[model samples]
Target: MWRDSFRLQIFCLLMAVLAIVVLVHNFFQLEHMDDDTISGSNWITENNVQHSLSQTTKTTRKPYCSYKQQTLSKREQAEQESLLAAILWPKPPDGKIAFVESTDPAHSDFVIVKPVRFFKVGDELEVLVRMKDFQGKPKQYGGDYLQARIHSPLLKAGATGRIVDCHNGLYKVFFTLLWPGEVKVSVSLVHPSEAIQVLLRLREERPDRVYFKSSFKSGKYSETTECNVCLPGDLPVCNFTDLYTGEPWFCYKPRKLSCASRISHAKGGYQKGLLTQEESLFFQSDVNIKRPILSSGPDSVIVKSKAFT
Candidate 1:
């Protein structure tokens, strides 16, 4: 009975040793496959990345956070302030809104109200602009961004005109006749008020809409990944900031290459879906943006020389 008991004890010890070996083997296998798993997974979201802290002794990893933003990081706070700044920024519009992102430059018109038979260089010229929509309906409120200038191609002279918004869709442009002979007026809608709002949102929320990339090389091995001024989430990043100028830069960590291996950088591409469908309507190339308003009556006025005054 004693010999049988001793043999059973020896067998139990061997089984325990075998169990430990299997556990250690499985652990290393998981570690080996970790990078491949992360890379193959769709781990990124609109504003965050879902990734656990990688196991590495050479690099720092953020503590796993099940709850995001319990305490705002400096980046989070800065993002909040940027969004707040958009609301606090000063702008013109002490009136109501006629439409939302509907200013059509093609349907808009400007006219020379007081056309004089003869004008001298010392005189001031005035022009009236009326804002309209694609349907040709008059805009009742102000706040459309405009650029106005008076230029004489023959005289090779040009000057910007001062614009005054009446808070009602009408804008008055005043130009001082400086070396003018056949001075022509031009008015362009740089952006509609609602489109400006969309821009402000993009500035506050998705400043990294235009992304970039970088390449890392170690011996014959190379890896490339996207980069930006700042990246989202707790995913690992390589800091490439300029210490002397205090300029900050960062890039997404490569799967195989270390941060120290980064050698080259270049533009990636514009991030998709930065704007909503409604907001995208404001930025069509052939639409209202940077389009010129037609002259209703006369686009040019002749001015006499100062000596002729």
Candidate 2:
């Protein structure tokens, strides 16, 4: 009976050891499987993160590339404009002209004529004419023909002025006074500048012609007027706004009359194409209404025409 009991205890101990071994092996296998699962999940998460980063990089770079393209396009456009300006710019004027002065061949903003009021017989006189644009801006381009004349209405004496082109918009007029009694100096354009004419033709819709104001001393002045170019026998009246200033002017002309006649000083009156420098200043000034001048001296009577040439 003692032997049998010892054999039974040994069997029980062996079975318990076998069960513990099985449990330990199962635990190690489970741990290894869990580690593999964790590693695979981490790899998948890393791949997802890398893909997201790639997508983000692509999205951000697209705008950068587009901006670079836009910058290049603008630079090219500016270069093209510069090239066109250099190529298409008009050349200066040169030719033989009678009773016209072309001095310096360079352009200026204002004309200076000295000793305008008082003069003696055989006294040499100088007159300067400046070329400017419609906006009262100095014109750098030159190619205009100018002519000058000095005559007295009361006297039989008259003199012709010599013009020297400065190659700019400026011209110098040289004349010797033949008579001293109330001599009138008049300058007219022998020929319009090709460049300026082309510009005017291109901007034909605009009224760029300069006109003198009638009764400027009486505080009554008009600068611009509009004319219609309709079919024959149509209404002659028209209204238009100035392109540069947006100021409104009105005029009327019958089919029998020229369109130029529409720019008369007063209604149904003849118009003159002379704008004095002082009167031009009045136009260029910031003042809205035409202000009356206190005519105190002969300077008020000295008329200087301001033309584009």
Candidate 3:
């Protein structure tokens, strides 16, 4: 019995020793795992802090915009006022003036007239005049009626007349000045009394070009005055006293003035006594300026004449 009890005590002591060894090993493993978790948590926190700092640095470097009050300078305000004045000013009733472009040799391209606007004393004014027809076609007239006139006190008195264009239609006249000053301009049309009036204040840097159109509704009639000029079946001829020369003149045989006749008349005076022979005058019966024969038909001739002064 004593020997059995001693064996049992020895077995119990060996089991206790094994249990203590296992418990020590487990405790060491648990400690190592805890250290790894702490390291991982520290790494994650460092990465989050670095990312937040990068975002903050980028935001600080970016540009920022905000609404602000705006204002104009004095010079800018003055310029705006000048432009507004020009826009609000009344335009000439007769339209604008333009240069005539024509191929006819008898017509003068530019009329010699005073500057359209007169600058202050000792100041030279430059004016540009352009003539355009009713159809808006450029450079069409080549005649004496279309011309430019400049009115000023220091310049020559009375209006200067010159042939500018022969084109039939509304004419546009443009005027400009080089210097600065207030000037009164009287725009006149030849033969036609209706003209345009314009008043302007010219400045050195603020040059202006004013516009006016000529009266197309006036001019002397070329046909007969007493009777209505009609072309029922054939062209009719008419005769009357020449307004300028008080001489007996005849529009040629075709009754209607030919292009050749117009060209001839525009070239100053034609040879008057060319047909002195008796036979020549007799043969030229159709060339005589006489009263036209009237037709009772519905197609009656209408006479167009200018109003006498």
Candidate 4:
């Protein structure tokens, strides 16, 4: 009787050990199956997020400026010639002389000539002009002559050419200090007959500083009464005070002027490009919410099953 009882006790102990082993193995296999399912779901979600972001980053067709030819009639040409003369040579009080050239390469006719009054030394001056074809349409010439000759003793002959690659119908001639005292600078325009004088001015210099106010509609446009200071053989530079924030900015080159303004405005979490609502949400989603299993050890299955169950 005692031997039988001992055998029964040993068999029961062995059965208990086998049952525990099988239960632990089954728990681990179930955990592995859940992990695989979760991993596949996470991969799908991540791939979707990346795909959405990429799609939003792509650029679609949009409206941009393009060049087009414009035509003008002969009667309109005469009226435009008259207007150009009046603007270029305004009157005695303005103190400037403007000469207009006909656009007809076949004919070199002086379309209009007028007298200007203002004159000063060491002053910054700007000559605004434009060129148009015989039909009075604004025309662009490959290379044009814009010359300024000072009659005073302090004057050194100076002229510059700006390439008219675009048909904007506007050109400017900028110069400074031909001579310090009372002086006169005669401005001339030469291009195939299509060129015309638009404006001439002896503008007073402002104080050393100026402020620029910018506004953004579809794009940006700025207004300021500032002059750029550039060293000889060095790149042009300008200092401008922001009208909106009253902050100061330095522009090392002309191309950077727009970029500087954009950067300044984009400081407070302002983004310029396209991003969809869903894409943005996905970017900000919390990855840990899915309860990712980062690592598993030999004892983790047994420990987790016992603790959670």
User: Once model 4 is optimally superposed onto the true structure by TM-score, how far is the C-alpha of residue 194 displaced, in angstroms?
Assistant: 9.7
Q: Which residue runs of candidate 1 sit more than 4 Å off their true CA positions?
A: 1-101, 155-157, 218-221, 242-247, 256-264
**Model 4 alpha-carbon miss at residue 70, Å:** 43
TM-score of each: 0.62, 0.30, 0.18, 0.21
Number of clashing residue pairs in every model? 0, 24, 24, 12
* Candidate number of the best TM-score: 1
- lDDT digits (tens) for residues 1-309 of candidate 2: 999999999999999999999999999987764543323212212112111111111011212112224333587779868987864533544332111232221222223365554555666777666664444454454556555767776657567888776756666878776654566666655344542343444344323243222110111211233222111223333333344432333333222333332222322233343334432332222221121211112311132323211
* Model 2 Cα shift for residue 160 (angstroms): 1.6
Cα RMSD, each candidate: 10.7, 32.0, 40.7, 32.5
1 versus 4: better lDDT goes to: 1
Cα error of candidate 2 at position 298, Å: 6.6
lDDT of each: 0.73, 0.42, 0.29, 0.32
Which candidate number maximizes lDDT?
1
lDDT of 1 by residue, 16-55 (tens): 9999999999999767655344331232322332211322
Q: Is candidate 3 or candidate 4 better by lDDT?
A: 4
Model 3 lDDT, full chain set: 0.29
Ranking by TM-score: 1, 2, 4, 3
Q: lDDT of model 4 at residue 121?
A: 41
Q: On residues 1-309, what C-alpha lDDT tens digit does candidate 3 reach at each position?
A: 999999999999999999999999999976764543323212212212111111111011111110012254698669768987764432323343321221111221222134332234333322323333323343432222334443445433323323222234223343433223233333332321111111122221112122111111112212211111111122222232234432222222322232122211211122233332432322222321121211112211111222311
